[model samples]
Target chain A: MSEFLGLYPYWVVIFLMMTGFYIVISRGNLIKKVIGLNIFQSSVFLLYISIGKVSGATAPITAEGFEVYGNPLPSVLILTAIVVGVATTSVALALVVRIREAYNTIEEDEIKDEIRTQGAGP
Target chain B: MTPSTDLLTALILTLLVGTAVAVVRMRGLFPALMLMGIFSLLGASWMLVLDAPDVAFTEAAVGAGVSTILGLTALALTARRAKTSSRKPWPALVIVTITGAALVYGMSDAPGVGDPAAPASKYPVPSYVERTDHDIHIPNVVTAVLASYRGFDTLGETVVIFTAGIAVLALIGGVAVSVRNTGPAGGRAGDGQGGDQPDELARGVEPAA
Candidate 1:
């Protein structure tokens, strides 16, 4: 059990990714889908972080006579992922606002019906 | 094989599985969103367990923080319940099941757990440990991998961010112009004085239940 314990990170990541994917694909609400997408993205962040781990490593800072420093690469990559996530959220929010104004309803089915009616020409 | 590590791993795995199930099984958007947030936090912790502080920090900030806010805001503005029925979802179930099976099968070929001689750890870890002075001066091998070997990927990522900002600015500009030009303030000829039937149709008529 102890030996298996070390694999917890990998298992957690897989679970989160699948869960997020399920939500994004199965959910009808745009907002819920976005939430799921965030979850999916976060799981990948976990995977990278796990890969960057060195056993018994301290933080990557130069201290006197310090030899065992943890990896900094995953953190840097995560920073980039964070920025991308923020940008995506902002754009998604803007799109939602536009959707609300254009369709007057955020329900996907309702929007589709409205579009269909418009396309049918009364 | 430490007891503390085993306990922590079990706890984290339980949380991860619970959140993942809740994310898919819960009907309420808010609950699912909240669960998803929990999942992100668990993922961050998992990263920390893996010694990836940077990834954990990003997951904390972006996944658990900004994304949750955005998701909540979007949910507030949108419909709460999805219109679709929460039933079997047979096709998805079948596909996911098959994929899971394949993944499990592939794992059999994977190296034994914690094999220090594994390809990943054998070369890079040793090289990184011994030759931190050359190739990359950075102490962190992960940083070296991202900024050096996969530098192009990092560059592409930066470009993608720039593109997103540009896209948002463009969207804002378009929206602003459409608002100004379509309204009475713009002085455009025949700008919405009639308030046509479509406009009336758009004015908050409750959909049939």
Candidate 2:
């Protein structure tokens, strides 16, 4: 039971990851797909942060009588990852807008249907 | 970890999972977007509980703040409710189940939370923690490592963000101009012909019609 308690967060991370994956695969809405991808990325962030944590340790700030500190490397790495995620999301949303403007619809099947009607070969 | 903190973490994780599930199940696009915002906020709080304040800060700012706004802007350009797909989702379900099982199998080997012997806690992490006060003098070792020790990587990340900003500006800027050019009275006709030309040029693709 204590073992489960110690590791429950990782299981939650996995569940979130699978949910994101399922949404990305099954959802037709482009914006929803982006949201799913964001969820996927955020779960990864959680995994890394959880790995970096040290029991009985405080935040990694230097001060008097503070010996134990959580690993700072993962936090720094995740900061970069979070910024990259936002940038990727913005670019993806821009592409979605462009797709809407050109295709007249954001639904994947409809876009494919339009392309087929136009006699555009896949 | 203390029992109370463990309980709090469990509660927060439950909220995160519930919000994520709700975001997936909600059909209304606006509500789903709002739920995504809530999801990010929960993720940020979870990060705070995990002892990663910098990550929590970035998650709150970017995930909850910027990404939600960007999603709304994109939705405004498109439709409100997502068009429901008629295709069967069985194949997706199978794939997701397989991937999830594989991930869970892999997790068995992962070190338990706060295991001091975990690879992440050894080597460079301890090195960084030890040398930070001497080399960077910053109170926050995360910032010191981000800005100094791994400065080049952060710079590369900044360049990537800058490029993305430029791409968005170029793509959306054309639409803004077209909207202004054709005012409200011109309406659909203005969108059909010349209004779309700039967008096509911006995308470097010919307009469909």
Candidate 3:
């Protein structure tokens, strides 16, 4: 039905958000968790861009024939977000590397076990 | 929306969702990382469809480009395959379902996609479209708004990125990482193992502050 189709974008965004959230919570792999974070961050970007859409409008470059343009504010905000997401991901990966050097494993449970054993030391 | 645009958006969204699920289930870290990059590309495409070329350009460069490279580099330094998790998925699955249902239901009040009457279209008095020409005289309104109107936010982002670079350098860039295991008289048993890290990562630069 047209009604259902009208909300398809919302449904998809939610599905992506939940999937990413689930991966972050349930998965033990640190790298996977980072990937999940990226997914989750991306869904937020999509939501912003989705809201900025204006039907039948061209890209926000002013031209002679075009009468309307999609919201540039959202595009601008999402641009900052995309850059920040990359920065966050790289920092996370760097931490994962350091964690691997120290703990010798990226698995959450294994890292916990390492901490426990190390805690017993002097 | 035209039929072609609708079709493109639908197709890209389907691919994006499918890729996200694949990343969740995949045990091999490499393939999962690849899928994540693909998801970014697909999302960028959809941004294009939504008439956000500026956003799509940035996402394609930073999201699909830099993130993938950094992920691959980190993958090289760490474990390649993920160990099977010992935890049950039931709790996560239940939480995701409940939250998703609530979010979907709540969206009923949101303006339909691309509705011209949406608040976003009207507000921000002296809209950028009108001001870009009269005031800034820029052909690309997105740039005018992002650079001139919102210059401070962009400047702040630059600072944040600079800070992130310093963090990366401290964590893995130089001698700070290797120095932890430098002297034989270093900390107890577990510390010595770091000395044998890969040749490229091995460096004798001064210890990080």
Q: Which number leads on DockQ? A: 2
* Model 3 agreement with the true structure over B34-85: per-residue lDDT tens digits: 8988998999999999999999988988888889899988876776788889
Candidate 3 structure lDDT: 0.84
Runs in model 1 with CA error above 4 Å? A1-12, A52-79, A120-122, B76-88, B112-114, B128-155, B172-209
Cα error, residue B71 of model 3, in Å, equals 0.2
lDDT by residue for model 2 (A80-121), tens:
999999999999998888777777677888888989898763
- Each prediction's Cα lDDT score? 0.64, 0.85, 0.84
Predicted candidate 1 versus true structure: per-residue lDDT over B1-209, tens digit per residue? 24786578678878788877777777677787787778778877876676666677777777778777877755654445555654457766666567655654544444433343445444445555456457777655566666786789889888987887787666555655554444444333324555332332212222221
Ranking by DockQ: 2, 3, 1
**What are the per-residue Cα lDDT tens digits for candidate 3 across A1-122?**
67767978988998999999999999999999999999999999999899999999898898888888888889989888888878888899999988877776789998888778788412
Encode model 2's per-residue lDDT on B96-193: one tens digit a residue: 88998888788877889888788888878778888888998878999999999999999999999999999999877887676456454355544777
Poorest lDDT segment (10 consecutive residues) of candidate 1 chain A: A2-11
Task: List, residue by residue over A18-83, the lDDT tens digit for candidate 1.
Answer: 777777666666766666777777767766665555555565543457666555655666767777
Which model, 1 or 2, shows the larger TM-score?
A: 2
Better model by lDDT: candidate 1 vs candidate 3 = 3
Residue A95's lDDT in candidate 1: 77
Residue A97's lDDT within candidate 2 is 82
